[model samples]
Target: MIRGVRGATTIEKDEPEIIFSEITKLVQEIVTANNIQPEDISSVVISTTTDIKSAFPAKAVRSLEGWQYVPTMCTHEIDVPGALPMCMRVLMHVNTEVHQKDIQHIYLNNAVSLRPDLVK
Candidate 1:
C-alpha cells in the first residue's frame, strides 16, 4: 500500500546552508521514524513558506545517498497571516505495509506548534 509520511521543520535563517541543513535533518528524521529506505520512497513533495526563497528543499534530499533516484518536487507554501516563517514541509510517498494510523509524522522546532498533537 502507498503511505504518506509527513514532516516539517523551521530554519534559523533564509540562507541556503541553514535551509539545506534543516531540511536534510527533517527528512532524515522522517525516514528514521518510519524505518523507510530510500528505495521504498516513490516520491517526495516539499514546500517552503513564502519567506524562504534561498533554496529548494528537494535539493537537500538529493544530497542524500541513493535519494537521487527518488522523484522529488519543491514548491512554495501559500503566505498566510501569522503563519510560521522559514518553515519547510515534506510529504513522502512510500510503499509500505504499515497501517496508516501507525505512521509517524514529525514536526520539529517552531513547526512543532503547527501540529501540537503529532509532536512527541
Candidate 2:
C-alpha cells in the first residue's frame, strides 16, 4: 500500500541554513519513525508559509544520501490570517505495508502545536 506521511516544522528565521537544517530534521524524523527507506519513497511535496523564502526545502530533501532520484516539489502554502509563520510542511508518499493508523506523522519545533492531537 502507498501511505502518505505528513510532517511540519517551524524555523526561527528565514535564513537558508535554518530552513535547510529544520527541514532536514523534519524529514529525517519522519523516515526514522516510520522505518522507511529512501528508495521506498515515491515522492515528497513540501510547502512553506509566505514568510519563508530564503531557500527551497526540496534542495535539502534531494541532498539526502540515496535520495538522489526521489521526486520532490516545493510550493508556498495557502496563507491564512493568524496562521503560523516560518512553517514548512511535507507530505511524503511512500510504498509501505504499514497501515494508515500506524504511520507516524512528524511535527517538530513550533509546528507541534499545529497538530497537537497527532503528536505522540
* Number of the top TM-score candidate: 2
31 Cα displacement, candidate 2 (Å): 0.3
Cα lDDT of candidate 2 equals 0.96
Q: Kindly report which residue pairs in candidate 1 clash with one another.
A: none
**Per-residue alpha-carbon lDDT of model 1 for 2-24, expressed as tens digits?**
99999999988899999888989
In model 2, pairs of residues that clash are none
TM-score of every candidate relative to the true structure: 0.97, 0.98
Model 1: how far residue 94 lies from native, Å: 0.7
Measured by lDDT, the strongest candidate is: 2
For every model shown, the clashing-pair count is 0, 0
The runs of at least 3 residues in candidate 1 whose Cα sits more than 4 Å from the true structure, single-residue gaps closed, are none
